[model samples]
Target: MFYISCTYKIMATFLYKCRDVGYDCGFEFSAHSRDDLMPRIRIHSRYAHNIYEMTDEMKKKVEEAIKQID
Candidate 1:
């Protein structure tokens, strides 16, 4: 008799909402990983909100607002 084993990996989607970060705009982003989501958020912040540079406090707020969806 022979036996085989397989493994499956599930990717969790990361979500960020502009409203979560105190923005009235209804902007939402989702990515398979946090690494990918952040760049998009930064770009949006720069162009839409005129946030050329994100301060440490803003960074913390953004981090706190990110959610992981399975």
Candidate 2:
């Protein structure tokens, strides 16, 4: 598991309640590696609180988004 601290300079968007790697608090990712892909994201599990469980729709979006990668 990776831990990422977010700031405006590095964090362009904050998706609340996102579900993929595990649960959801605020989806924090780094575009530095996935800049070439659609809504490129690198998930982080550094949330201060427990991530809310993922819903079916949210899970699908996350899985789809992740599958687009190498």
Clashes of each: 0, 0
Candidate 2 Cα lDDT to native: 0.43
Compared with the true structure, model 1 gives a TM-score of: 0.87
- For each candidate, what TM-score against the reference? 0.87, 0.28
Q: In order, what lDDT does every prediction score? A: 0.94, 0.43
lDDT of 1 by residue, 1-70 (tens): 8999989898899999999989999999999988998899999999999999999999999999999998
The candidate 1 region of ten consecutive residues with least summed lDDT is 1-10
> What clash pairs does model 1 have?
none
